[model samples]
Target: MIDNQLGIRKPRGLTAALSILTTYTPGGGRVPYEDEVGSDGLLRYKFQGNPQHYTNAGLRAAFREGVPLIWFFGIQQGVYLPFFPVWIVGVEAEQSQVAVALDEAQRSLPIGGVSSEIERRYSLGITRRRLHQPVFRQRVIQAYESACAMCRLRHRSLLDAAHIIPDRDTRGVPAIANGVSLCKIHHAAYDENILGIRPDYVVEVRADILREIDGPMLKHGLQELHHHALALPRRRADQPDPVLLEERYDRFRTAS
Candidate 1:
């Protein structure tokens, strides 16, 4: 019964079908809103001013020991409503705590739990196609032997499997034909439309970048790649699809 004094408002009908996972208490008052989540999937909550308070330390330990923590949101009508409980799994320090929601099946799937509830409404073929993404990067990286298609950078840690058409697009399939292994720098440039790849696999720097007399990173890392063909996969079928490349290249061209 710690007066954390913050609350998370759940959307209407969010707990309607997932009631089994949610916990409710009547007149629980307001809960704190200071939950900070990171890209690495660690959600942190600091126990206000006295972060090392006994209660905070105890709860942090429980969370790290896999204890389920009920996230209370305040009372609605005569009942205290809370969202689905999350399993506390990590404690970076006595004051900082981390936890993940209890949705094993959904969490294990790709794309941050697109929610089977929502995805069930889509066609089976679409769902099945999207599900293959967990293995998509592996297949693409293997095809390129973990090298960047643009600069032939061989550092696996700095490489990414990029999509010709964004993964969110309806036409973007999780097949090797729609993927290219690129280094982190190239991926960012591609995403920002500062760099583009033609349908014929030739690289192109945005017109503005080509004109800018910048440093070595800009000149050699980007401009030098202009008109150079992407280092394609050894297997012809693993090469990026020309149609998808054309579609994406059009967007990059428009941005440039």
Candidate 2:
């Protein structure tokens, strides 16, 4: 933290003394002490090595005053997902760690720690999705250059990261390879099985839908995409997993 510029940041000359911002980069180069949010939906932010350090004092003050801070989670170089208003709920001197909560509900939890694995998971399942979706969307959207895989719609507001295998599935993960960038319409359609993407990168409209009479959106936006090749990321690592794509395609086939 001393040498590396990113970590807990405390604004100088503040009245109550506060660490206003912090940053986390998943799998980015190592840090002396890592700040992590586990499946329990609690973030453990380790203070500076010295408990009496100014930064540590600032963090403690933030907790004491019930103040919130920004957590900038790095997605790529110069790209970050900013999670704001995260509260410092507790400070553990033994570990020199502060308990950070991403939302109000999390702030209300037993910040010392939630012991039972099942209970912790149950409480945080929804919270996990809240954290997962934004990061997943950013990563997937960037991978596809912010365009729909089928239609190539370039509007950032209209785009979404559709999971190839859903978050509920055991095989699903927030990894870029498990997501496909699509516009809102196509995302909903993919989720509803109105359309599917084959492992070979082909887009397919449901047979029944293709046979139906509908508006221009049905014709130009969807039907026209049938048999068309899926738009893929240039980076080989970011390309959709063929196995996951096939698995979802099977469900779409059955639904068809």
Candidate 3:
């Protein structure tokens, strides 16, 4: 809330584009400039179509003054994730795009560009860890239609995107095919190997858990899911990869 501005679409105190973040082509239409992020931990935001555009000037003002702004990154239709107080770290006038940084470490680097190879590499590593999982979760949840694969629960808040392969593994790319939508309980069970999914897309409960006498959660939530076919996405590409599923399932078998 800079300069008493009522909306985010305007400049704040003539210094910053007040929380400047824009989504393209969901409902309004395609944006003339396509923005992209580089592995260098910098987001190259496309310049405005008009050289004299007020917002472009506003962005320049923000860059000059080192003001903070919010970046509303759209992950899917009707869904946006807000990254607040991001810095206008650099302005590449020749390239017609500006560099934005997501973290303080990156923001503290050189004024015009990425500072050093070591610092940049570290920044990139942190940026990936910060951004990719949330985007991955959104994609996975969208594929599953916001329902849990095990219980078919449709509550959005209860849903989570569980990784088929752990992120530490080389093969654990943040893609829909490498993820599964589960409720919090099932997600915990999957992580603990208390429950597992076969490559065939069938659910399985651990032998000990299956035999144990417990509450309804233990019975219906875990046991009843045994032999149940995991709900899958309609699009084959968005469905979990069987090979990855098998890889993760192996761990579950071992742990169980």
lDDT of 3 by residue, 149-240 (tens): 98999999999999999866766776777899999999999999999999999998999998999899788878998899999988776788
Please rank every candidate by TM-score, starting with the best.
Answer: 2, 3, 1
Model 1 C-alpha lDDT versus the unseen true structure? 0.60
Could you tell me the TM-score of candidate 1? 0.53
User: Could you give candidate 2's per-residue lDDT for residues 1-256 as a string of tens digits?
Assistant: 1213635677668523333333333322342113265545676777767888777788898889897777665555566677777788888898778877877877766654554776477546745566667877887898788899888899999999999999777567677888999999999999999999899989999998899898998899889989999989988878998988899899999998
Point out the higher-scoring one by lDDT: 1 or 3. Answer: 3
Off by over 4 Å in 1: 1-131
> In candidate 2, which residue ranges exceed 4 Å CA deviation?
1-4, 14-36, 46-57, 92-96, 112-126
- List TM-scores for all candidates, in order: 0.53, 0.80, 0.71
Order the candidate numbers by lDDT, best to worst: 2, 3, 1
The per-prediction CA RMSD against the true structure, in angstroms, equals: 18.3, 4.1, 5.5
